[model samples]
Target chain A: MNAPPITTASAESPALPNRFDLTAAIKDGLKTALIMLGLSIPILAYKTDQSGGDLWLSPRWGLVAILCALVFGLRILLHAFMATKAAREATPSPHQATEFVHAEPNAFQKTSRFAIPFFLGVALAFPVIIYFIQGGLNESRYWVDLGILILTYVMLGWGLNIVVGLAGLLDLGYVAFYAVGAYSYALLSTTFGLSFWICLPLAGILAGFWGMILGFPVLRLRGDYLAIVTLAFGEIIRLVLINWTDLTNGGAGISSIPRATFFGLPFTSGEGGFAQTFGLEFNGMHRIIFLYYLILALALLTNFVTMRLRKLPVGRAWEALREDEIACRSLGINTTNVKLTAFAIGAMFGGFAGSFFAVRQGFVSPESFNFLESAIILAIVVLGGMGSQIGVAIAAIVLVGGPEILRNLTFLQAVFGSGFDPNEYRLLLFGAGMVAMMVWRPRGLISERSPTVILKERKAISGSLVKEGHG
Target chain B: MRWIQDPLLDVQHLTMRFGGLVAINDLSFKVGRGDITALIGPNGAGKTTVFNCITGFYKPTEGLIAMRKPDGSNLLLERLPGNSINWKAKVARTFQNIRLFSGMTLLENLLVAQHNPLMLSSGYTFLGILGLGGYRTAEKEAIEKAKFWLEKTRLIDRADDPAGDLPYGDQRRLEIARAMCTDPLLLCLDEPAAGLNPRESLELNNLLLSIRKDHGTSLLLIEHDMSVVMEISDHVVVLDYGTKIADGTPSEVKSDPRVIAAYLGVDDEEVEQVEAEIGV
Candidate 1:
């Protein structure tokens, strides 16, 4: 398909065309469809055979798919030729507009003045909208599972955003807190036969305690040294989980673990099961839906608390510390207390999410909380935009939820033949998307909001007029 | 001799060392209430070092920097950490290389200087995040204070502009405005006129004079420009090799043979020329 016109000049440039047609969009769409169809047929045929179905549909449809693919491919080549010819025929124009970049926003252009209300409205209405639409209420177990997954990552993203985003502290081993929370809940609940509710706070407290423990050694360290220490701390937590067999279940994992009950009612078909006791029909989806709402609530609470903390003096202190440590110190702000509070609070949230994870899975394993988990969570925070609550939620949805949505594309299997699985290429696509996002928006989806101070006359100022450092 | 009131800041035997080199050695000076004292020296005379030591940037090996507050409470600045020095002593300062929060607007930079006051108004409550009631009031007050300084510094028109984007002269004035927003009792300035043109320097002189006239805030300055020193300073102290060589009024220090020797790089020949130049 033909590429879009570069349109390199600014909006005011006289060289710009009056209107550029998006006619190539249709051809591009057709090309993509044909390519996918050409690749999916054999794979669908193989799957059909494995499921004991007709064999002829695969080969017959494959030929037709290839033929259409060839036609689209030739069209793409022709379009490219036409685009180059058109470009060469056009005369060069030179009326470029001057672009002005501002370092800071004006009082009138303050981001917080608008963003706080916008995000709060979204957070408040999201559950109501989901309920009205009956989202996850009648869906298969996987839909509810997907909801839980999104919530889990959302909480983790918020937690990690505090450490890495708000504080400008790169934590490569944040999963250590997750592990500490999960294992604490698992060990305590199982050993004492306690319920999930009671153990949850205990687990979070334990994780927060460990965060302080970790914070002490890295107090004087910054940047790379702090990252390495946190990474080692995570490894230490994982190693202990693996080596300490008596306390934990070792590599075997705590299987046949008790699933979290709904207000003490199990989902089983027993006398005390939720379905039987409530006179409702038994469906595994009920349990999944319950877990989904449970996690969604927790995630919302995490976001709410984080948002509140950020507006406080401590929150501003954290931001100031992030911007310039020397300045923060000169202002009489205690850097040590600020750093410790951030670590503890961030870890506490992680622990809450981890405890919820253990209850949701009904099993705890060291393998689940690995370096990759830490990396993925960190990526979510970075990609979402640091120091932004809503950005983390949006990023989690795209990064974690995107792969699951891709799994439902059965049409891709038909085009790729028997050997190709779309899941295998999900990470490759994810990596490419990340690269594209970085190039397109280096400051992440939402840039830092400028602080508003009341001017004598309260005159509005445009953000572009201000000059502030981006980083 | 008019003793005036007690010195707002008293520095005794202030010594700072960087390994083998002594940046400030046994330096003693007293800045009287509402006095604009100039610490003048040749380059590398450790004028800025003394400022740093007094501001708690560098801990002196042996010294007592007692800042007498309006309430007559003494704050031993040397014993406090760098962060606590600002709050306890109410001593504000400006850097030779202006360190305004570049990404913040001119008004926001000023308000940030009042961070402690705003925190107190909020009672450090989480409800402050919602910006309800009291927090809103405090925020409004902060803005008013910021605007007051902006007007004072003649930056009201560009209050919403980012501080870093301002013209060089405006940035220097904004730095002073930011420091003033802290409501400090004493202001320490390090080479505020280093890069300013003649007109800008005159404006700065006017601003500093107005500050002393209106706020009654004592000024401690380290400057190389003899014009600035002789123009505004009530008293001048000359240093050579981290030791004080002369301390008196600008005219008295200007006439001191020792001060002349330190500036002219001569023991005898240049001294006569220095006296002639000062009309002494």
Candidate 2:
């Protein structure tokens, strides 16, 4: 077979202006502005009931028109500057494309690394900041609930990252483990009258056991076939949950499930409850705060463990397996063990999150663990940058937490009127954002940083040099 | 001098069949310890098939492939899984087509070759994941070993570069270095000089000789380059139509009438005439 054209080397040559020049940025900005403007026009016109009004001068369209015009003007200016810069640079004669472009972190890479942690930290502290500023301790329950949701998804994203990102296993039905954890907690807690903490690890163990069972059959398969089997396994779990009506309570779901108590003390109006035991005033917000902290700790622990694993031999094996299974085997890596470990670890974390979900919500049902849950988790991993901890967290926030935050945007009602619901279009925006990100950066928002072993003499040669086989 | 000792790799009555077609029919050979054995053959001669069988890439339909391990134990290669074949059996191999991890760095590629060593140090522990003291020592040792091979292969300067970015000849050499980093008892190289220029081919020959002499590694190489085979190989095994036609010292194999006829495509009647003319 003829050698594939090497595109990365040519793109990296010093003679050629970087493709990420101002022109590209301007073009990108214009594209985003145009799309936003296009959607805004229809919504604004419809909301304002200005079908026959003048297109540009109408009060209904004034702000959007100005924004679109300003965006276009700025794009043109940026493109002009970039074009002038490119014209001044000397071009090299063409040569055989032998160089590779291994991905190295450029100037923008450091910014992204900083951005992810900063963004997550901000999101995590958002509720506390709001609580102090607004004195919303009375309404702290909703903020606490939001925090729990964010932390749960964050944990789930990290879990799925192990299977899909590190091992390159495409699991479309990861929610099965979540279901297992939730059900395990629900069944055991309700039947034995066990506390949430007792059932938590048990739930994780049960899910991990199920993960290994599924892993065994699909060990021999790869790519699409493995994905299909895992998908079916997920369906099977969901089906069992639906069909096992006597135990699960079927579609109706188990309600009035015992709320998780703080140690042995219940958070209730009773004399011997948590508030009375501690000699503190009774408030439902305290319970919300407690659940929030619990989930947060769990999420942090999951991140810490996953991060540690990535540096280990097992983690490296997973990456190698992802890149090329045959090569991994040749390197004396037991791919079966690698695959199984990834599944077990990923499912174990999923179980942890699932049990947390059950305890926090005080309910468990098949509806909670559907195909959509898998998609959202996978989307978080992909959109956040595969195998990236901070990226997954960021993606979960923007995709899951972003929509919820939009619910409190009281000002949007002034423009679109009370008839407009921002939440309805949040998904559409989320999808568009994903597509845009994919097109702009196929490697996700934050590409993995290679483990640096050698410090170079020259001004740290571009990763492209390494990618081209120069190393 | 140790040629009288039992061969490090002993393949007896080796046969491989693909459905109705017999690819290798009762091929038997011995690759002596610390000797470079070259396998040469015409197109579709199944030289690579033999290498694949020896490396456990493919199981022979019928035969015995017993490779001596460093610990003085016999490893039935065909019975072991491909991954374990490299680790436990200590038999490393390079493909005809370069199989270097293209996306990984040069150092990373070499470290990957020392997969078993690092795995042992890690003890597959959570502490290893944290790059703890034990893991750090392993990492240092792995880097040292990788650097050693890189310097030997004249790629130390490009240690931080990507494996795929190297020129074609360098990639071929890097593949060798990667295999050697495993510290295997037997190194199987499939057409090491296939696409290299004369200079690179000479470098490859020196590399192979050094590996055999300095490292005491036995070689089972498949090469179409007669120059490399004749120059470095102590023993030559020629395969024609998946059957062993000749096996002897380089001089003996080069003088063999069957090998000459196979290469020159002499007819049955002309074989006698050609042999008489060549005074073989």
Candidate 3:
């Protein structure tokens, strides 16, 4: 490799490209094969099983050998591909081929402009589409249930996006606010007999209050310290719900919480029910349809308000704070209050989604509000490409709906074995998917950043240009 | 050098100590209203320490840092809390290392600097989101102010480009443009010409001069560039080892024996010798 390049350079006309070196390529492949052999030996070569006091060894050296050989071949192919790519790049094209006079709209930009409204239209007509396809509300129960689940996660993802995405605050305990909302609706409607509509706002306000309480102490902390304190705050909320038997009923949970009504109309079999008031045939799907629409509306509310706020002075302050705190203070923006407002608003939306969860489930418990749920929601916010609403919605559908779809894949049991469950491997697949996502597209799916407030013509910028890497 | 006796700012016995290493000792100086005051010192001379104290980034261990208005009212700057030094007291500052919101556009940087007034009219974010006319008009006016500054800085064409993507000279100008958007009474710039080429450095001096002439905004800047400091400054305050060694007109301070000795790394007795040897 060194001799060929030197000879070409000394010739004064280095026209020939650096030829691919087969020996070097073989050397690289051998190294990869060695590493794979070492890894596959422990993880794949042998498996042990013990039944009643007897142990059995199952050897799979053949599988390990095949994998190592496959990796070695793939390494050589990759080297050849990369070498050709470099040669092509080194051969300069015409000036017009590379020079860009000005930036034109990219493929991502054009597709994104179409993707948002298209997804929204689908979301709007989702229940009706399901009703027509399943033939009736009675038969489409599973699909509608899946829709509700996806929308709920979508709502939660948007709420967390405000804090972790826009303001650039790493809040690992966002689910605590969700729990606060759920518990607030559960307690208020159950203990006081308040209607769901009345308790909804109260739940959101209470959650916002809790958000401020969490915000005050953590104002001075940033990055990892901020995340740790927030994580602790979430755990404390969960523990309190578990131990305080007087309010939360301890581990037994609160059940038969009041159902979310259709405004003043009930979804009942008797008169004055939603079906009866409309004179439509009595069906259980009315409630499902209403719940589907309810969550869709709530999620849209979160998205719109957040988008609008991004154009406001307060919203600009949030982004500025994310960029640089010292710059924010020097500009006369009160960073303390700015951070607190972010917490309050984000938690308020979380609370709204939480109340919706309580109504949909008719139950509230500490089990529903755990650290894992917070981690999942935060993952969705990041994986959706922070500060991008459409990205979050797409991420929510993939992360949430993907597993739900797997639960319905009964064919997997027959192919693998009768005892095999595909859901068991969901986490493994999810981990692999996230790893692939990070390696290939580190800035989530749609990483284009446009100014929230444009003074002149709007221009698209690369997302990582301003991305806060602390989280 | 033209100046006013009734200083717009008065610093009395300002002492800022970080443990045993006093970053700023019992130092005192005044900035005249509608005048450019240049603070010059060698490395570790606490020029930036004085800036941090005035901007409320640091609290002095002992001192009175006051800002006076022509109406006979004064604000004790060191007594002011965080961000209020800029928000309420109208003392905006730039950094030695550029600190623009690199991800934000040039126009957004200016708009963010006008946050205090915009925050109020937007009803602390609620009314603004409602798309009310009052907030919209205020936002529009704020944009006009931003555009004004952008025009002055000659950066209006690429106003939408991210601040970090700009050339070095443009980034420095954008920082000043951002601070000016606050409509500040006093603008403090740390090394405004540190990284600029000679031509760009001359342009920055003109910008600072125009800001003082047209807006009546006082400026205090720390600069190693003698051309910039000596060209535009009305008053000069020199520091060494956190203590004020010379304070007067730029010409007088430039020739001060103590300042020459401090900068030349010579003892006071050997200052004359060094000055003769260097042919200054």
> What C-alpha lDDT do the candidate models reach, one value each?
0.77, 0.80, 0.89
Off by over 4 Å in 3: A1-20, A31-65, A81-105, A409-421, A469-471, B1-4, B267-280
| Clash pairs for candidate 3 | none
Q: Could you give candidate 2's per-residue lDDT for residues B184-265 as a string of tens digits?
A: 8899999999999998899889989998889999998999999999999988999999989899899999998889889989
Distance from true position, residue A462, model 1, in Å?
Answer: 12
User: Which digits, one per residue and each the tens of the lDDT, describe model 2 over residues A175-272?
Assistant: 99999998888888888988888898999999999989988998887767887888899989999999999999997776656777888788897889
Q: fnat, candidate 3?
A: 0.83
Give the winner by TM-score: 3
Give per-residue lDDT, candidate 2, residue B266.
Answer: 78
The CAPRI quality class of candidate 2 comes to: acceptable
All candidates in order of DockQ, best leading: 3, 2, 1
| Global Cα lDDT for candidate 2 | 0.80
For residues B237-265, write the lDDT of model 3, one tens digit per residue: 99999999889988899888778788887
User: Pairing residues by index, what is the TM-score of model 3?
Assistant: 0.92
lDDT of 3 by residue, A255-313 (tens): 99988788989889898988888899988878988999999999999999999988888
Give residue A47's error in model 3 in angstroms. Answer: 7.2
